[model samples]
Target: MSRIQCPRCQRPQSHCLCPLIPCLDSRTRVLLLQHPSEVNHALNTARLAALGLNNAELIVGEVFEDLPRLLNQPGYRARLLFPADDAQPIQTYGASDEPLLLVVPDGTWRKARKILHLNPLLAALPRVTLADGGVSRYRLRKAPGPGALSTVEAIVQALQVLEAPVSFEPLLRPFEALIEGQIAAMGEETFRRNHAGK
Candidate 1:
Protein backbone atom coordinates (compact mmCIF):
# COMPACT_ATOMS: atom_id res chain seq x y z
CA MET A 1 0.00 0.00 0.00
CA SER A 2 1.15 3.51 -0.77
CA ARG A 3 1.02 6.45 1.60
CA ILE A 4 -1.13 9.31 0.42
CA GLN A 5 0.43 12.73 0.31
CA CYS A 6 -1.02 16.18 0.74
CA PRO A 7 -0.94 17.99 -2.60
CA ARG A 8 -0.24 21.36 -1.04
CA CYS A 9 2.47 20.63 1.52
CA GLN A 10 3.59 17.33 -0.03
CA ARG A 11 3.78 15.36 3.19
CA PRO A 12 2.09 12.09 3.97
CA GLN A 13 -1.61 12.78 4.42
CA SER A 14 -1.47 11.77 8.09
CA HIS A 15 1.56 14.00 8.56
CA CYS A 16 0.31 16.79 6.39
CA LEU A 17 1.64 20.15 7.59
CA CYS A 18 -0.66 22.41 5.58
CA PRO A 19 -3.00 23.10 8.45
CA LEU A 20 -0.08 24.37 10.53
CA ILE A 21 1.03 26.86 7.91
CA PRO A 22 -0.28 30.42 7.70
CA CYS A 23 -0.86 32.47 4.58
CA LEU A 24 1.44 35.45 4.43
CA ASP A 25 2.18 37.95 1.68
CA SER A 26 5.68 39.29 1.75
CA ARG A 27 7.26 42.30 0.09
CA THR A 28 10.52 40.39 -0.32
CA ARG A 29 10.14 37.57 -2.77
CA VAL A 30 11.77 34.28 -1.73
CA LEU A 31 13.32 31.94 -4.28
CA LEU A 32 14.59 28.70 -2.84
CA LEU A 33 17.27 26.90 -4.81
CA GLN A 34 17.11 23.56 -3.13
CA HIS A 35 19.48 20.69 -3.71
CA PRO A 36 17.70 17.64 -5.04
CA SER A 37 18.65 15.61 -1.97
CA GLU A 38 16.68 17.87 0.39
CA VAL A 39 13.38 17.53 -1.46
CA ASN A 40 12.22 14.48 0.49
CA HIS A 41 13.69 15.01 3.95
CA ALA A 42 11.02 14.38 6.60
CA LEU A 43 12.01 17.57 8.41
CA ASN A 44 12.21 19.76 5.33
CA THR A 45 11.31 23.35 6.27
CA ALA A 46 11.83 25.05 2.92
CA ARG A 47 8.60 23.57 1.63
CA LEU A 48 6.76 24.87 4.69
CA ALA A 49 8.28 28.32 4.33
CA ALA A 50 7.34 28.46 0.67
CA LEU A 51 3.87 27.16 1.41
CA GLY A 52 3.24 29.82 4.05
CA LEU A 53 4.39 32.67 1.88
CA ASN A 54 2.37 34.12 -0.97
CA ASN A 55 5.47 35.43 -2.72
CA ALA A 56 7.81 32.46 -2.45
CA GLU A 57 8.93 29.91 -5.03
CA LEU A 58 10.90 26.66 -4.67
CA ILE A 59 12.98 25.09 -7.43
CA VAL A 60 14.83 21.82 -6.83
CA GLY A 61 18.10 21.00 -8.58
CA GLU A 62 21.85 20.96 -8.22
CA VAL A 63 22.53 23.22 -11.15
CA PHE A 64 20.08 25.98 -12.06
CA GLU A 65 20.37 26.37 -15.83
CA ASP A 66 17.77 29.13 -16.00
CA LEU A 67 19.50 31.31 -13.42
CA PRO A 68 20.47 33.97 -15.93
CA ARG A 69 16.89 34.61 -16.92
CA LEU A 70 15.71 34.34 -13.34
CA LEU A 71 18.14 36.95 -12.10
CA ASN A 72 17.32 39.26 -14.98
CA GLN A 73 13.61 39.29 -14.33
CA PRO A 74 12.21 42.76 -13.79
CA GLY A 75 10.53 44.32 -10.73
CA TYR A 76 13.04 42.89 -8.24
CA ARG A 77 16.74 42.95 -7.53
CA ALA A 78 18.24 39.51 -7.01
CA ARG A 79 20.41 39.00 -3.94
CA LEU A 80 22.08 35.88 -2.64
CA LEU A 81 21.55 35.04 1.04
CA PHE A 82 24.95 33.66 1.87
CA PRO A 83 27.27 34.88 4.56
CA ALA A 84 30.48 35.50 2.72
CA ASP A 85 33.02 37.52 4.64
CA ASP A 86 32.37 40.53 2.44
CA ALA A 87 28.61 40.16 2.40
CA GLN A 88 26.55 43.12 3.46
CA PRO A 89 24.13 43.08 6.37
CA ILE A 90 20.46 43.08 5.38
CA GLN A 91 18.42 46.30 5.49
CA THR A 92 14.74 46.78 6.24
CA TYR A 93 14.13 48.18 2.73
CA GLY A 94 12.86 51.34 4.36
CA ALA A 95 14.40 53.56 1.71
CA SER A 96 14.43 51.33 -1.34
CA ASP A 97 11.69 51.01 -3.94
CA GLU A 98 12.90 47.83 -5.60
CA PRO A 99 11.51 44.54 -4.42
CA LEU A 100 13.96 42.11 -2.80
CA LEU A 101 14.52 38.81 -4.52
CA LEU A 102 16.11 36.64 -1.84
CA VAL A 103 17.79 33.67 -3.45
CA VAL A 104 18.48 31.10 -0.73
CA PRO A 105 20.22 27.79 -1.33
CA ASP A 106 18.63 25.01 0.72
CA GLY A 107 20.64 21.94 1.68
CA THR A 108 23.25 20.71 4.09
CA TRP A 109 26.37 22.80 4.27
CA ARG A 110 28.22 20.61 1.78
CA LYS A 111 25.39 20.68 -0.71
CA ALA A 112 24.83 24.37 -0.21
CA ARG A 113 28.52 24.96 -0.88
CA LYS A 114 28.29 22.84 -4.02
CA ILE A 115 25.35 24.91 -5.23
CA LEU A 116 27.36 28.08 -4.77
CA HIS A 117 30.46 26.58 -6.35
CA LEU A 118 28.59 25.36 -9.43
CA ASN A 119 26.44 28.44 -9.96
CA PRO A 120 28.44 31.40 -11.20
CA LEU A 121 25.44 33.66 -11.37
CA LEU A 122 24.77 32.98 -7.72
CA ALA A 123 28.38 33.61 -6.82
CA ALA A 124 28.46 36.93 -8.61
CA LEU A 125 25.25 38.23 -7.11
CA PRO A 126 25.49 40.67 -4.23
CA ARG A 127 25.54 38.69 -0.99
CA VAL A 128 23.84 39.55 2.30
CA THR A 129 24.14 38.19 5.85
CA LEU A 130 22.18 38.23 9.06
CA ALA A 131 24.34 39.83 11.71
CA ASP A 132 22.63 39.12 15.04
CA GLY A 133 19.97 36.46 14.72
CA GLY A 134 19.56 34.66 18.08
CA VAL A 135 19.94 30.89 18.45
CA SER A 136 18.03 28.71 16.05
CA ARG A 137 14.74 27.33 17.22
CA TYR A 138 15.20 24.20 15.14
CA ARG A 139 16.44 21.66 17.63
CA LEU A 140 16.08 18.75 15.23
CA ARG A 141 19.34 19.39 13.40
CA LYS A 142 22.76 20.14 14.78
CA ALA A 143 24.27 23.26 13.26
CA PRO A 144 27.88 23.47 12.12
CA GLY A 145 28.76 26.32 14.45
CA PRO A 146 27.50 28.78 16.97
CA GLY A 147 24.90 31.22 15.61
CA ALA A 148 24.21 28.95 12.64
CA LEU A 149 20.52 28.71 11.86
CA SER A 150 18.20 26.47 9.95
CA THR A 151 17.05 27.63 6.52
CA VAL A 152 13.65 28.59 7.87
CA GLU A 153 15.15 30.38 10.84
CA ALA A 154 17.54 32.32 8.65
CA ILE A 155 14.73 33.28 6.29
CA VAL A 156 12.52 34.32 9.19
CA GLN A 157 15.22 36.55 10.63
CA ALA A 158 15.96 37.92 7.20
CA LEU A 159 12.34 38.73 6.66
CA GLN A 160 12.20 40.39 10.06
CA VAL A 161 15.08 42.60 9.03
CA LEU A 162 13.96 43.22 5.45
CA GLU A 163 10.32 43.77 6.30
CA ALA A 164 8.54 44.15 9.62
CA PRO A 165 8.96 41.75 12.53
CA VAL A 166 5.24 41.03 12.39
CA SER A 167 5.41 40.29 8.70
CA PHE A 168 7.46 37.17 9.35
CA GLU A 169 5.97 36.10 12.65
CA PRO A 170 3.35 33.93 10.98
CA LEU A 171 5.98 32.18 8.95
CA LEU A 172 7.37 30.65 12.15
CA ARG A 173 4.11 29.89 13.89
CA PRO A 174 3.95 26.37 12.50
CA PHE A 175 7.62 25.79 13.16
CA GLU A 176 7.02 26.15 16.86
CA ALA A 177 4.14 23.72 16.66
CA LEU A 178 6.24 21.17 14.82
CA ILE A 179 8.91 21.31 17.49
CA GLU A 180 6.36 20.93 20.24
CA GLY A 181 4.80 17.97 18.48
CA GLN A 182 8.17 16.28 18.24
CA ILE A 183 8.79 16.79 21.92
CA ALA A 184 5.35 15.49 22.74
CA ALA A 185 6.04 12.36 20.72
CA MET A 186 9.17 11.81 22.72
CA GLY A 187 7.10 12.11 25.88
CA GLU A 188 7.98 14.02 29.00
CA GLU A 189 10.66 11.72 30.37
CA THR A 190 12.69 11.52 27.19
CA PHE A 191 12.17 15.18 26.49
CA ARG A 192 13.17 16.04 30.02
CA ARG A 193 16.36 13.98 29.81
CA ASN A 194 17.29 15.52 26.48
CA HIS A 195 16.68 19.03 27.69
CA ALA A 196 17.64 18.46 31.30
CA GLY A 197 20.71 20.66 31.53
CA LYS A 198 19.84 23.10 28.76
Candidate 2:
Protein backbone atom coordinates (compact mmCIF):
# COMPACT_ATOMS: atom_id res chain seq x y z
CA MET A 1 0.00 0.00 0.00
CA SER A 2 1.16 3.54 -0.70
CA ARG A 3 2.16 5.65 2.25
CA ILE A 4 -0.32 8.22 3.47
CA GLN A 5 0.44 11.77 2.41
CA CYS A 6 0.53 14.67 4.85
CA PRO A 7 -2.43 16.97 4.24
CA ARG A 8 -0.36 20.03 4.95
CA CYS A 9 2.97 19.17 3.28
CA GLN A 10 1.24 16.67 0.99
CA ARG A 11 4.25 14.47 1.66
CA PRO A 12 2.83 11.71 3.83
CA GLN A 13 0.26 13.65 5.85
CA SER A 14 1.76 11.92 8.87
CA HIS A 15 4.95 13.93 8.32
CA CYS A 16 3.13 17.15 7.48
CA LEU A 17 3.17 19.71 10.23
CA CYS A 18 1.87 22.58 8.12
CA PRO A 19 -0.40 23.38 11.03
CA LEU A 20 2.68 24.84 12.66
CA ILE A 21 2.82 27.47 9.95
CA PRO A 22 3.31 30.93 11.47
CA CYS A 23 1.20 34.03 10.96
CA LEU A 24 2.69 37.47 10.38
CA ASP A 25 1.46 40.97 11.28
CA SER A 26 2.31 43.28 8.42
CA ARG A 27 1.09 46.75 7.49
CA THR A 28 2.14 46.66 3.85
CA ARG A 29 -0.32 44.80 1.68
CA VAL A 30 0.95 41.82 -0.35
CA LEU A 31 -0.71 40.95 -3.65
CA LEU A 32 0.33 37.56 -4.98
CA LEU A 33 -0.56 37.07 -8.66
CA GLN A 34 0.26 33.42 -8.96
CA HIS A 35 -0.24 31.20 -12.00
CA PRO A 36 -2.97 28.60 -11.75
CA SER A 37 -0.37 25.85 -12.04
CA GLU A 38 1.35 27.05 -8.89
CA VAL A 39 -1.74 27.20 -6.69
CA ASN A 40 -1.81 23.45 -5.97
CA HIS A 41 1.91 22.86 -5.95
CA ALA A 42 3.15 21.30 -2.74
CA LEU A 43 6.44 23.18 -2.86
CA ASN A 44 4.91 26.56 -3.67
CA THR A 45 5.94 29.17 -1.07
CA ALA A 46 3.42 31.84 -2.07
CA ARG A 47 0.62 29.91 -0.43
CA LEU A 48 2.62 29.73 2.79
CA ALA A 49 3.24 33.45 2.81
CA ALA A 50 -0.41 34.25 2.10
CA LEU A 51 -1.46 32.04 4.98
CA GLY A 52 0.85 33.93 7.32
CA LEU A 53 0.02 37.50 6.42
CA ASN A 54 -3.31 39.22 7.16
CA ASN A 55 -3.22 41.65 4.26
CA ALA A 56 -2.17 39.15 1.60
CA GLU A 57 -4.30 38.42 -1.46
CA LEU A 58 -3.45 35.44 -3.63
CA ILE A 59 -5.09 35.55 -7.06
CA VAL A 60 -4.65 32.46 -9.21
CA GLY A 61 -5.43 33.27 -12.80
CA GLU A 62 -4.05 33.92 -16.27
CA VAL A 63 -4.23 37.69 -16.14
CA PHE A 64 -4.94 40.72 -13.95
CA GLU A 65 -8.09 41.57 -15.92
CA ASP A 66 -10.21 42.97 -13.08
CA LEU A 67 -7.35 43.59 -10.67
CA PRO A 68 -6.81 47.23 -11.54
CA ARG A 69 -10.50 48.09 -11.08
CA LEU A 70 -10.45 46.24 -7.76
CA LEU A 71 -7.39 48.14 -6.61
CA ASN A 72 -9.09 51.38 -7.58
CA GLN A 73 -12.01 50.51 -5.36
CA PRO A 74 -10.13 50.74 -2.04
CA GLY A 75 -6.68 51.32 -0.53
CA TYR A 76 -4.29 49.63 -2.94
CA ARG A 77 -0.99 50.53 -4.50
CA ALA A 78 0.36 48.45 -7.35
CA ARG A 79 3.96 47.22 -7.69
CA LEU A 80 5.50 44.22 -9.35
CA LEU A 81 7.79 42.04 -7.25
CA PHE A 82 10.44 40.78 -9.63
CA PRO A 83 14.22 40.90 -9.62
CA ALA A 84 15.69 44.40 -9.31
CA ASP A 85 18.26 44.20 -12.04
CA ASP A 86 18.63 47.07 -14.52
CA ALA A 87 14.85 47.44 -14.41
CA GLN A 88 14.20 49.48 -11.22
CA PRO A 89 14.93 49.82 -7.52
CA ILE A 90 12.60 48.63 -4.78
CA GLN A 91 10.44 51.40 -3.36
CA THR A 92 10.28 52.30 0.33
CA TYR A 93 6.99 52.54 2.22
CA GLY A 94 6.12 55.28 4.70
CA ALA A 95 3.87 55.08 7.77
CA SER A 96 0.89 56.54 5.90
CA ASP A 97 1.96 55.13 2.60
CA GLU A 98 -0.35 53.42 0.15
CA PRO A 99 -0.54 49.65 0.03
CA LEU A 100 2.69 48.19 -1.34
CA LEU A 101 1.91 45.97 -4.29
CA LEU A 102 3.88 42.72 -4.45
CA VAL A 103 3.27 40.78 -7.66
CA VAL A 104 5.00 37.42 -7.35
CA PRO A 105 4.81 35.37 -10.55
CA ASP A 106 5.04 31.75 -9.47
CA GLY A 107 6.33 29.00 -11.77
CA THR A 108 9.43 27.55 -13.34
CA TRP A 109 11.76 29.90 -15.24
CA ARG A 110 9.96 29.43 -18.53
CA LYS A 111 6.52 29.57 -16.98
CA ALA A 112 7.35 32.72 -15.02
CA ARG A 113 8.58 34.46 -18.13
CA LYS A 114 5.41 33.44 -19.90
CA ILE A 115 3.31 34.77 -17.08
CA LEU A 116 5.03 38.12 -17.34
CA HIS A 117 4.78 38.28 -21.10
CA LEU A 118 1.17 37.22 -21.19
CA ASN A 119 0.04 39.64 -18.52
CA PRO A 120 0.66 43.18 -19.77
CA LEU A 121 -0.95 44.86 -16.75
CA LEU A 122 1.47 43.16 -14.38
CA ALA A 123 4.35 44.00 -16.69
CA ALA A 124 3.32 47.64 -16.58
CA LEU A 125 3.53 47.84 -12.79
CA PRO A 126 6.64 49.29 -11.14
CA ARG A 127 9.14 46.45 -10.95
CA VAL A 128 11.04 45.93 -7.70
CA THR A 129 13.72 43.30 -7.07
CA LEU A 130 15.06 41.87 -3.87
CA ALA A 131 18.76 42.26 -2.90
CA ASP A 132 19.18 39.61 -0.22
CA GLY A 133 22.56 37.90 0.17
CA GLY A 134 21.13 34.55 1.13
CA VAL A 135 20.35 31.21 -0.48
CA SER A 136 16.83 30.02 -1.28
CA ARG A 137 15.09 27.30 0.73
CA TYR A 138 13.16 26.14 -2.35
CA ARG A 139 15.38 23.09 -2.84
CA LEU A 140 12.76 21.24 -4.84
CA ARG A 141 12.90 23.71 -7.73
CA LYS A 142 15.94 25.10 -9.54
CA ALA A 143 16.23 28.88 -9.54
CA PRO A 144 16.91 30.82 -12.71
CA GLY A 145 19.73 32.72 -11.01
CA PRO A 146 21.55 33.28 -7.73
CA GLY A 147 19.20 36.15 -6.85
CA ALA A 148 16.17 34.01 -7.53
CA LEU A 149 14.37 33.89 -4.18
CA SER A 150 11.15 32.12 -3.27
CA THR A 151 7.94 34.12 -2.88
CA VAL A 152 7.94 33.91 0.92
CA GLU A 153 11.64 34.76 1.21
CA ALA A 154 11.26 37.57 -1.27
CA ILE A 155 8.32 39.00 0.71
CA VAL A 156 10.31 38.87 3.94
CA GLN A 157 13.21 40.69 2.33
CA ALA A 158 10.82 43.19 0.78
CA LEU A 159 9.20 43.79 4.15
CA GLN A 160 12.62 44.50 5.63
CA VAL A 161 13.31 46.92 2.80
CA LEU A 162 10.06 48.73 3.60
CA GLU A 163 11.26 48.96 7.26
CA ALA A 164 8.58 46.64 8.55
CA PRO A 165 9.26 45.15 11.98
CA VAL A 166 10.52 41.65 12.75
CA SER A 167 6.96 40.46 12.89
CA PHE A 168 7.52 38.61 9.60
CA GLU A 169 10.42 36.54 10.95
CA PRO A 170 8.07 34.07 12.57
CA LEU A 171 6.54 33.39 9.15
CA LEU A 172 9.85 32.02 7.86
CA ARG A 173 10.66 29.64 10.70
CA PRO A 174 8.29 26.93 9.46
CA PHE A 175 9.95 26.96 6.06
CA GLU A 176 13.05 25.36 7.56
CA ALA A 177 10.92 22.68 9.12
CA LEU A 178 9.11 22.18 5.83
CA ILE A 179 12.38 21.63 3.99
CA GLU A 180 13.65 19.26 6.65
CA GLY A 181 10.44 17.29 6.49
CA GLN A 182 10.64 17.00 2.70
CA ILE A 183 14.24 15.82 2.84
CA ALA A 184 13.40 13.21 5.46
CA ALA A 185 10.49 11.93 3.37
CA MET A 186 12.71 11.60 0.34
CA GLY A 187 15.25 9.70 2.40
CA GLU A 188 12.57 7.36 3.66
CA GLU A 189 11.38 6.69 0.11
CA THR A 190 14.92 6.00 -1.05
CA PHE A 191 15.51 3.61 1.86
CA ARG A 192 12.35 1.70 1.08
CA ARG A 193 13.35 1.34 -2.57
CA ASN A 194 16.80 0.05 -1.65
CA HIS A 195 15.38 -2.42 0.85
CA ALA A 196 12.92 -3.75 -1.70
CA GLY A 197 15.76 -4.26 -4.17
CA LYS A 198 17.75 -6.20 -1.56
Candidate 3:
Protein backbone atom coordinates (compact mmCIF):
# COMPACT_ATOMS: atom_id res chain seq x y z
CA MET A 1 0.00 0.00 0.00
CA SER A 2 1.10 3.53 -0.62
CA ARG A 3 2.27 5.39 2.41
CA ILE A 4 -0.09 7.95 3.86
CA GLN A 5 0.88 11.43 2.77
CA CYS A 6 0.57 14.91 4.18
CA PRO A 7 -2.28 16.78 2.50
CA ARG A 8 -0.27 19.98 2.41
CA CYS A 9 3.27 18.97 1.45
CA GLN A 10 2.17 15.74 -0.30
CA ARG A 11 5.11 13.89 1.19
CA PRO A 12 4.56 10.65 3.04
CA GLN A 13 3.57 11.47 6.61
CA SER A 14 6.92 10.42 7.97
CA HIS A 15 8.70 12.74 5.57
CA CYS A 16 6.30 15.70 5.56
CA LEU A 17 8.05 19.02 4.97
CA CYS A 18 5.50 21.29 6.64
CA PRO A 19 7.60 22.06 9.67
CA LEU A 20 10.48 23.35 7.63
CA ILE A 21 8.41 25.52 5.32
CA PRO A 22 8.61 29.19 6.25
CA CYS A 23 5.87 31.80 6.41
CA LEU A 24 7.93 34.79 5.45
CA ASP A 25 6.59 38.02 3.96
CA SER A 26 7.93 39.66 0.84
CA ARG A 27 7.65 43.02 -0.85
CA THR A 28 7.29 41.35 -4.23
CA ARG A 29 4.43 38.98 -4.98
CA VAL A 30 5.14 35.60 -6.60
CA LEU A 31 2.82 33.76 -8.95
CA LEU A 32 3.91 30.26 -9.94
CA LEU A 33 2.29 29.04 -13.15
CA GLN A 34 3.06 25.37 -13.10
CA HIS A 35 2.55 22.84 -15.87
CA PRO A 36 0.26 20.01 -14.72
CA SER A 37 2.91 17.39 -15.39
CA GLU A 38 5.13 18.64 -12.59
CA VAL A 39 2.64 18.27 -9.74
CA ASN A 40 3.47 14.64 -9.02
CA HIS A 41 7.22 14.87 -9.40
CA ALA A 42 9.17 13.79 -6.31
CA LEU A 43 10.72 17.15 -5.56
CA ASN A 44 7.83 19.51 -6.21
CA THR A 45 9.89 22.60 -5.53
CA ALA A 46 7.26 24.98 -6.79
CA ARG A 47 4.90 23.82 -4.08
CA LEU A 48 7.61 24.45 -1.52
CA ALA A 49 8.00 28.01 -2.75
CA ALA A 50 4.26 28.68 -2.57
CA LEU A 51 4.09 27.38 0.96
CA GLY A 52 7.09 29.34 2.19
CA LEU A 53 6.21 32.80 1.02
CA ASN A 54 3.31 34.89 2.29
CA ASN A 55 2.69 36.64 -1.02
CA ALA A 56 2.73 33.68 -3.37
CA GLU A 57 0.26 31.57 -5.33
CA LEU A 58 0.60 28.37 -7.37
CA ILE A 59 -1.80 27.53 -10.16
CA VAL A 60 -1.25 24.37 -12.20
CA GLY A 61 -2.59 23.83 -15.71
CA GLU A 62 -1.73 23.89 -19.40
CA VAL A 63 -3.56 27.11 -20.22
CA PHE A 64 -4.80 29.42 -17.56
CA GLU A 65 -8.19 30.86 -18.51
CA ASP A 66 -8.00 33.46 -15.73
CA LEU A 67 -4.80 35.13 -16.82
CA PRO A 68 -6.13 38.68 -16.60
CA ARG A 69 -7.45 38.32 -13.07
CA LEU A 70 -4.24 36.64 -11.97
CA LEU A 71 -2.09 39.39 -13.41
CA ASN A 72 -4.08 42.40 -12.26
CA GLN A 73 -3.13 42.80 -8.62
CA PRO A 74 -3.07 46.47 -7.67
CA GLY A 75 0.19 48.26 -6.87
CA TYR A 76 2.36 45.69 -8.63
CA ARG A 77 3.53 45.20 -12.19
CA ALA A 78 3.51 41.71 -13.63
CA ARG A 79 6.80 40.50 -15.05
CA LEU A 80 7.72 37.09 -16.38
CA LEU A 81 10.71 35.51 -14.73
CA PHE A 82 12.05 33.85 -17.83
CA PRO A 83 15.25 34.37 -19.73
CA ALA A 84 15.56 36.09 -23.07
CA ASP A 85 18.17 38.12 -24.90
CA ASP A 86 16.50 41.37 -23.97
CA ALA A 87 15.28 40.36 -20.55
CA GLN A 88 16.06 42.80 -17.76
CA PRO A 89 18.10 41.47 -14.86
CA ILE A 90 16.02 41.69 -11.66
CA GLN A 91 17.30 44.16 -9.09
CA THR A 92 16.58 45.58 -5.65
CA TYR A 93 13.76 48.10 -5.65
CA GLY A 94 13.51 51.55 -4.09
CA ALA A 95 10.55 53.02 -2.19
CA SER A 96 9.34 54.99 -5.17
CA ASP A 97 9.09 52.07 -7.61
CA GLU A 98 6.09 49.73 -7.72
CA PRO A 99 6.77 46.22 -6.52
CA LEU A 100 6.70 43.32 -8.95
CA LEU A 101 4.19 40.54 -9.34
CA LEU A 102 6.73 37.95 -10.44
CA VAL A 103 5.05 35.40 -12.66
CA VAL A 104 7.19 32.27 -12.83
CA PRO A 105 6.65 29.33 -15.15
CA ASP A 106 7.51 26.04 -13.46
CA GLY A 107 8.27 22.92 -15.45
CA THR A 108 10.90 21.42 -17.72
CA TRP A 109 12.06 23.98 -20.29
CA ARG A 110 9.93 22.51 -23.08
CA LYS A 111 6.79 22.30 -20.96
CA ALA A 112 7.33 25.78 -19.60
CA ARG A 113 7.53 27.11 -23.14
CA LYS A 114 4.31 25.33 -23.97
CA ILE A 115 2.55 27.18 -21.15
CA LEU A 116 3.84 30.47 -22.51
CA HIS A 117 2.63 29.55 -26.01
CA LEU A 118 -0.81 28.70 -24.73
CA ASN A 119 -1.17 31.76 -22.55
CA PRO A 120 -0.52 34.74 -24.78
CA LEU A 121 -0.91 37.27 -21.99
CA LEU A 122 1.76 35.55 -19.93
CA ALA A 123 4.05 35.65 -22.92
CA ALA A 124 3.60 39.38 -23.32
CA LEU A 125 4.74 40.37 -19.86
CA PRO A 126 8.03 42.22 -19.52
CA ARG A 127 10.68 39.57 -18.89
CA VAL A 128 13.14 39.67 -16.03
CA THR A 129 15.91 37.14 -15.50
CA LEU A 130 18.18 36.13 -12.69
CA ALA A 131 21.84 36.95 -13.17
CA ASP A 132 24.12 34.40 -14.78
CA GLY A 133 26.05 32.03 -12.46
CA GLY A 134 23.22 31.21 -10.00
CA VAL A 135 23.55 27.40 -9.59
CA SER A 136 21.00 24.62 -9.19
CA ARG A 137 20.79 22.71 -5.94
CA TYR A 138 18.62 19.98 -7.44
CA ARG A 139 20.84 16.89 -7.60
CA LEU A 140 18.60 14.17 -9.01
CA ARG A 141 18.19 15.57 -12.50
CA LYS A 142 21.00 16.88 -14.67
CA ALA A 143 20.37 20.55 -15.47
CA PRO A 144 19.70 21.29 -19.14
CA GLY A 145 22.38 24.01 -18.98
CA PRO A 146 24.49 26.09 -16.66
CA GLY A 147 22.67 28.59 -14.38
CA ALA A 148 19.61 26.32 -14.30
CA LEU A 149 17.72 26.37 -11.03
CA SER A 150 14.71 24.52 -9.65
CA THR A 151 11.52 26.56 -9.23
CA VAL A 152 12.03 27.32 -5.53
CA GLU A 153 15.69 28.12 -6.12
CA ALA A 154 14.75 30.55 -8.86
CA ILE A 155 12.16 32.21 -6.60
CA VAL A 156 14.64 32.50 -3.76
CA GLN A 157 17.25 34.00 -6.05
CA ALA A 158 14.77 36.40 -7.59
CA LEU A 159 13.48 37.48 -4.20
CA GLN A 160 17.03 37.89 -2.98
CA VAL A 161 17.64 40.29 -5.83
CA LEU A 162 14.29 42.09 -5.83
CA GLU A 163 14.17 42.47 -2.07
CA ALA A 164 17.82 42.66 -1.13
CA PRO A 165 18.79 43.19 2.55
CA VAL A 166 16.07 40.70 3.50
CA SER A 167 17.33 37.13 3.65
CA PHE A 168 15.29 34.54 1.77
CA GLU A 169 17.48 31.70 2.97
CA PRO A 170 14.77 30.37 5.27
CA LEU A 171 12.73 29.55 2.18
CA LEU A 172 15.30 26.93 1.22
CA ARG A 173 15.09 24.75 4.31
CA PRO A 174 12.48 22.29 3.05
CA PHE A 175 14.15 22.15 -0.36
CA GLU A 176 17.47 21.10 1.14
CA ALA A 177 15.74 18.55 3.32
CA LEU A 178 13.93 17.09 0.33
CA ILE A 179 17.18 16.70 -1.59
CA GLU A 180 18.80 14.95 1.37
CA GLY A 181 15.85 12.59 1.63
CA GLN A 182 16.06 11.71 -2.06
CA ILE A 183 19.79 11.05 -1.79
CA ALA A 184 19.26 8.88 1.26
CA ALA A 185 16.61 6.77 -0.47
CA MET A 186 18.76 6.17 -3.54
CA GLY A 187 21.75 5.01 -1.53
CA GLU A 188 25.05 6.88 -1.25
CA GLU A 189 26.81 4.57 -3.68
CA THR A 190 24.20 5.07 -6.38
CA PHE A 191 24.16 8.84 -5.92
CA ARG A 192 27.97 9.00 -6.07
CA ARG A 193 28.06 6.90 -9.22
CA ASN A 194 25.37 8.84 -11.04
CA HIS A 195 24.87 12.37 -9.69
CA ALA A 196 27.72 13.27 -7.37
CA GLY A 197 30.14 14.70 -9.89
CA LYS A 198 27.67 16.79 -11.80
Best-fitting candidate, scored by lDDT: 3
lDDT of 1 by residue, 1-198 (tens): 989988887777877777779888888899999999999887678888898888999999989999998787689999999888889999878665797899999999899999999998898999999976368887755667777887888898899888865568777877777777777778978977776435
Taking all chains together, each candidate's TM-score versus the true structure is 0.91, 0.79, 0.99
Query: Which residue pairs in model 3 clash with each other?
Result: none
Off by over 4 Å in 2: 1-12, 84-86, 188-198
Model 3 lDDT tens row, 2-59: 9999999999999999999999999999999999999999999999999999999999
- For candidate 2, the TM-score is 0.79
lDDT of 3 at 87: 98
Top TM-score prediction, candidate number: 3
lDDT of 1 at 160: 88
- Stronger candidate by lDDT (2 vs 3): 3
lDDT of the structure predicted as candidate 3:
0.95
**Which stretches of candidate 1 lie above 4 Å from their native place?**
191-198
Q: Candidate 2, after superposition: displacement of residue 56 in Å?
A: 0.4
lDDT, candidates in the order shown: 0.84, 0.70, 0.95
User: Model 2: per-residue lDDT, tens digit, 1-198?
Assistant: 988876544545665656767766676778777888886676667777887787787778776688666455366667777754555666567667876656677766667778878877767777877765657766655666676777788888888777544546767866767766666767966645543223
| Descending-TM-score candidate ranking | 3, 1, 2
Q: Count of backbone clashes for each model? A: 0, 5, 0
